[model samples]
Target chain A: MTDMLPTGATIGILGGGQLGRMLSVAASRLGFKTHIFEPGANPPAGQVADRVTTAGYDDIAALEAFADSVDVITYEFENIPTTALDALEAHKPIRPGREALRVSQDRLTEKDFLSGLGLKVAPYANVESPDDMASAVAQIGAPSILKTRRFGYDGKGQARLKSGADADAALVDMQGAPAVLEGFVTFTHEVSVIAARGIGGDVACFDPGQNVHKDGILDTTTVPANLTASQRMDAVLLAANILNALDYVGVMGVELFVTQQGLIVNEIAPRVHNSGHWTQQGCTIDQFEQHIRAVAGWPLGDGSRYADVVMENLIGDDMDRVPEITREGNASLHLYGKADTKPGRKMGHVNRITPRQN
Target chain B: MTDMLPTGATIGILGGGQLGRMLSVAASRLGFKTHIFEPGANPPAGQVADRVTTAGYDDIAALEAFADSVDVITYEFENIPTTALDALEAHKPIRPGREALRVSQDRLTEKDFLSGLGLKVAPYANVESPDDMASAVAQIGAPSILKTRRFGYDGKGQARLKSGADADAALVDMQGAPAVLEGFVTFTHEVSVIAARGIGGDVACFDPGQNVHKDGILDTTTVPANLTASQRMDAVLLAANILNALDYVGVMGVELFVTQQGLIVNEIAPRVHNSGHWTQQGCTIDQFEQHIRAVAGWPLGDGSRYADVVMENLIGDDMDRVPEITREGNASLHLYGKADTKPGRKMGHVNRITPRQN
Candidate 1:
């Protein structure tokens, strides 16, 4: 039973967002039940999960009870509170492990880890105070992005440094939080490799998907991305290198910037990523199920691409287009049951699949 | 809201079986919440449904509460008690309606309805007692089946009549229940069409699938079923005819017997059928989602087959083969989180997908 979770075993999830919702559905497919722990009432994942603890991560008692009820623990987001992890890990194993989370929870640690593994990453310098920002700007030069070292997502908590004069203004954006000044790497496009590592240390990566972002949020991801044969291999190999370096178990989203020199590591997330949502229609096994299999100690599934797909996020008013999308052939819609639709919120996504081009 | 259920609407499901489990997952994809009503403790569907009411259909108070919570209602199985429908329909609209349940609940009524619509049906006669059994055997001839008109599924409540001399013995198997004596139709292979009709009366049907039954239970269903061009067309047309005649607003599985002369109607299930499970991998929108869409008052989705699939049921001890199946490339395992596998029980199924042949 330790080698793999038996059928009907409960998998504890730390977040109850759309990723957790999809993961719960995938776990159910493999005969595994999911228990979601979220502070928010009526979280989307709670609608599909077997059990939900509507207590915040700071509530140690609720966290312990949730951990005790599940056989294994995984998460939808990487930035889990440290105290919550300490309480849960004592009862059950947290998959993708603490090391993967440690490396990914901060932009600085992730870049350093990727670079230490001899993988290409954009040049960066740590920034803390105004003095640190001045030095980082001098080292990295203008046209660099200042991103907070921790707790930043969907392009929040960051400011662009167009010139050295903008450094103080950018530092103000961080609000005294530690930051990283990353030198911009001129790239043709952004692509992400959704990779998984089994408990047995076996690695599998889905085809890279070219992505487009609108207002700092992912707009669409098209599979069979424009990559040379060598670039594709490099992208997968670099992802596997990162996973192996961390001794990672479960899926990791490896975002890469396709540059003239090579595929530069942008960042990594130690759970299912939005760009990989295309696998729901492009492959036999989706990223959510792949993550579940790894965390549950099952062999990684085949990640072969079987269809050409373009996954588009349904943000806010994009939901108004649902009726039209419902009528469109080849478009598969996945909507998160959120009560309110606000601008920039991810309501869901649609995967438009077509016959494979190659 | 009258034309189509808005996202976040609750769909009340009548039964909590594997069909309900899959339907709940499908409903979640469309941002719909599901409330499952099952008498049994820890029903498989409860693992994924948004809510569960553990009460029998005879509990009028519980049924009314469930119906009040949902915007629409549907069932996984057709043989819902009349009293349950009476309580539920008064609260929320039940898609596929009571007409479908009435026609399909009794075999004699179903056969007559098909024949009445100019559809070919196996020769059949009603049986109420020993005298009726003798007359049925005389009229339908030898090599027939005696089936209880109600509560029959998975080859249950049935006995074979090999000859006139076996009439009394087959009557004993009925145990005084109303029955149907049906002459077996000579056929090459059995096929079924998974059809759906929208609230607006538009119809869509998935490609026919060839079925193989072992121990009176479906073993496997292969898409691109060996049907000639004309036989395939006839299969879909007959299925649409039934839905149109019944004014059905959900998915229906129409089992057809392919004879040398033509396609003959066997029976129709007013919900997603096991034989249609192959569509999970072979079609853009599987039958479960198709049923949800129709019941939710949305337009029918694309049911076009995208891959060749062989859906194999994992029954009883076949659960032992799950580890091996999980490793098989192009195979998608869907296990019902049912504890304790006994002989002749359905544990789950796997869809092995391959490129479409034609």
Candidate 2:
């Protein structure tokens, strides 16, 4: 029986980005406290949480103290060091467990897991070394992508292959690190389905969102995704299946590509996602609240929307146009407490809610 | 004209109850830093804010330093001394300003302002001394309430008089302090309209909430109030008229009694009102956020709800049922980080949103 946590329990979170910040807000709204563990000088989540452990990920004593302080452990980002998780697991439960991380840390392993679940995936091969790279590329063919798999986010750690000469150069550029060669798909659009699973195995999903990315980062996510009814059903079923198979006890995002042929898996994020930010304004219970409920051992709220929504990320300099956007439409502006607006940084987002009726 | 008070500006908040706590959350959400100013050692609002200024209200040095550090000053409760407001106003602006607080702090003065606007109010009189008590009671009625005209909340600082014999005793019991005697209303129901006036004189009101009170404190507020379209129209008009009269900038909650005669004014809070907590889940922008926007010189957001909502306060030991309440329905729960929950104290509230088919 899952009886370790109660309503007033404190949940430990790693990483202090907007996801963690939103997670802390959601946790408080549900009678729970969140203690954020972040390495930086100041994490955005620290501004609104009960407590914060400001120590590097490798600081064992800090990690030990953090583990001693919280009831259970969860993370906002998946790139937390394996050793850190191993040490924390000695004391508290880490939901979506370390096994899920092992399966997802490497691109080759992730694709294998998706194929094992009988899900559609891009043709992929493991690039063990530069010597074996040419043969692997020949099998996967040109116009493929070479990805490091582990610790890659926002289009980093991945190289695109366009021709035979480019394959060897990409493999050599990767420097013998274990990589995966994924055949490129001619997809019409990209979408993500965010779902959650409670400890009791109860599952709920938000409507899928059609996402547009620029410079390899999320730009906009529109709900009521441009998908056929059957295709939307397939996305939810796929997300739930992934959560169940991993025994996940929180929210997870499943990103996929919609092509003329069918749905192809792109990636899996085992936490609250950016694409679901529209829920804050459009739905009764949002993804962050749903994630908190699942992990806190409470029943999930109804995740139904009363309006159609469009959420646009205010990346870096885009934040300067908040006044203009506010004047243009009845949009809700959310700016993160970031100190410097450097290039490629996520500054904030704006949510525009429209009546369902045309 | 509104420049330099950007996202990272710190706001100094006086009082640290649930109102201050919610204001701190909303302030942090907009990338603004909040520094809570309260005399107590531990206040719930401190848990989420950036800093806490623990000093006596009259400590002019601490107050000066606090005002110097923050861009502006605001408070949760309206009973703050005029001297403190004077000292702070010398350094920074006070939103909704001191005039609004002075009027709302004195019940007799508040009634004058409302009556000046031709709004309906219970017949009242000022009793400055025991010599005038009998005349004041006779002018109002036998079944009238004798209340101190200043600094009263949650059934405190007042006594009720049912007959002529008891009227003298009630007047003596109040120690010959300044008081108002009001004829009791046999109202059909009670409701409140929470409205806001931005710095640019923009006015917006949430749907009026039908309220229930226990021990003269708000117990629950149900939206999609049991009011006819005409009544709703009157409520909005009354609130807007008050805003224009006061030249107010920030949220205001007006308590009203729906009597057989007509709508009668009960009381008015010049800041974010407790009865409006439902706006957090029911609307795209909550009253707290709207107030922050008005004070910060940002454009107001849409204060419209897409669904009907019921918000119930969790007072004192009622917080013990938080786990059960959170699991029973699609309720969004909010708990203040108070260490002790004394009797009749508001520890938090829960909002249940139920979409209406109109």
Candidate 3:
């Protein structure tokens, strides 16, 4: 039957963070159970999920056991080790596949894949060694960001090089790994299109929201972002093409750089994303539930927005303001159970929904 | 600092049904863990919760351990034995308390309590024995019901006395137990108010919805309830008064019968009610989350309805329609993990959100 995931069907998810926690909540709403496997210290997802296996990323035995328990498997984030994927894929259906992982895990491959899709990306050069770094610096010039080709997340594992003299230290910092020096682009704004694609190839997108970062961490996202109507349409169209191209089945957060010419793809998160948190109070379906529905092979839910939204992350001590934030009638507070409130950690968030009905 | 219950807090839930399941889901959302203590062989809440302790209803040792691990306690259904509650109350904070449970679990007590609050109730009489039943039958007459004073639910342990001959058999069927015989009132419609009150005495009521029952099981609930403005005001007033009287701290569903005389109080559910499931898709705060917020000592949410709604339960084999039900653009489906779907068992429910602004 169409959009019917049989009862007792299990959905395996990789990465056990807030994304997985929210995903598990959504999966339960649709009659599917989520089994989360994450190699971390009691990830939040473990709390709400039906089952969880805490094993290191390269632990093939645990990965295989996890894969065997579920009907379909999806990941909360890119950068899952290829070996882990190889083992999981052998036993379960992994949506978005090795190709989506291969491309999005590294900036260089991501750019190349997008470029292959005839999308515009910033100029770049690979730095394999000091010699290659020197030549790559000569080609890409000053003010380029030298980034390790893998394992970088949330602005970590990269160094911005303003001159050639810093090349040696940058390469040494990267520890003899292959890297890319990408030319900096002057962009109008940073925005992301949080979208989902069903296995049957239907795609739905939330309107692009302007994102602002503080110290390389997402600080806030406001809907009705400073984009022309055409730009919004362009973002959805581009996201749908990529989802179909990769045959991706799940919600993806497509970060894009809005330039004067058009939108340039930034990166893609193959799960429910932070930027779409507004959906919790602003839309017919939240991104996490939407993602679960897609991966469970269920029909995509209505993605219509009911309100103009402003979402602010409750970082570290900001969680202390939860009582105050939630006291406002318009705010929808969501807290992720993190034990320690260390600085810069995303402890929770609040979405203030103001209906645009008037 | 205000509502944060320390880390590793275990929230103990008494009844392990879907309300508990959904509550566990919300509790998990806030980083709080759950331990489901149930007497049933299998509890739907146990499927997604962190821990489950299955034992007899009167097992004091099991109840004690369940309470020991939990920071705060709550129950899904109102029928917790007073002895079991006494054991639990010795260890943890049981929100809504034994008084509320005692009042709601017995139809006689519930009706009496509402009547004491000056709320309108159907004419009623207590039947403690067959002789008491006969005397009450003389007063209440035919077309009334004889309900066991305790441990009755979903039309179980209740019998309709259509005539004097049936009255003796009804009391005999009631098995010499304490019972309540009520005069039947002709009603134009049935409705219920799903509301919550916080420890601080904050009261929030969702608009009452008209309910329809098939074979004594709730079949559907439509919000706006076809109640006139005065009727809606009366329903909310009755609900608020009930919460205040009980000093209740959680979501409660108060069923009402609207007759030519006015709205008559039917019964109350001390926890999330099936009739209130529409809140998931209709309101900013669903009953499950509203109950959590109340028990957690947080401020009550707005409980704002975003749209008109209709909720249908997927009882027993009715769950087979999930595929077709979910395909509707507006319905939100919720299913429990029951290994076997038996006749008369509630497997799940679906909420249909009608197209309207909040």
Best by TM-score: 1
Model 2 chain A scores worst on lDDT over the 10 consecutive residues at A1-10
Q: What is the TM-score of each candidate against the true structure?
A: 0.99, 0.96, 0.96
Poorly placed runs, candidate 2 (over 4 Å) = A1-4, B1-4, B172-176
Write model 1 residue lDDT over A1-358, tens digit each, in one string.
2488899999999999999999999999999999999999999999998999999999999999999999999999999988899999999999989998888888988888888888888889999887788888889998999999999999999899888889889998988899999999999999999999999999999999999999999999998999999999999998998888889999999999999888888999999999999999999999999999999999889899999999999999999999999999999999999999999999999999999987
- Residue B112's C-alpha lDDT in candidate 3? 88
Whose lDDT is higher: candidate 1's or candidate 2's?
1
Error of 1 at A179 (Å): 0.6
Model 1 docking grade: medium
Listed models, DockQ each: 0.79, 0.55, 0.53
Summarize candidate 2's per-residue lDDT along B15-120 as a digit string, tens digits: 8777988998898878888888899986778777778889887999998999998987888999988888888899999988887998899999999999999999
| Tens digit per residue, CA lDDT, model 2, A48-110 | 887888999899889999999998888888888888998899988887678777777777788
Q: Tens-digit lDDT track for model 3 on A1-358?
A: 5555687688888888877788888777776777989888778887777788999988889988888888999888888888888888888778867777887888788888889999878778888888888899899887878888888877888888878888788888888778888888879899999998887888888878889988888989998788877888998899988888888888888899999878988778776788998887777678988887787777888787767889898888887676676567867777777767888898888887766542
Sort candidate 3 into its docking category: medium
iRMS per model in Å: 1.4, 2.5, 2.1
Clash pairs of candidate 3? Answer: none
lDDT of each: 0.94, 0.85, 0.83
Residue A125, model 3: Cα distance from true site in angstroms: 1.8
**lDDT (Cα, tens digit) per residue for candidate 3, span B216-327:** 8999998868888888998999899999988889999899999999989888888888999888878767788788888878788888776788888999989878767756
- When 1 and 2 are scored with TM-score, the better candidate is 1
Q: How does model 1 score on DockQ?
A: 0.79
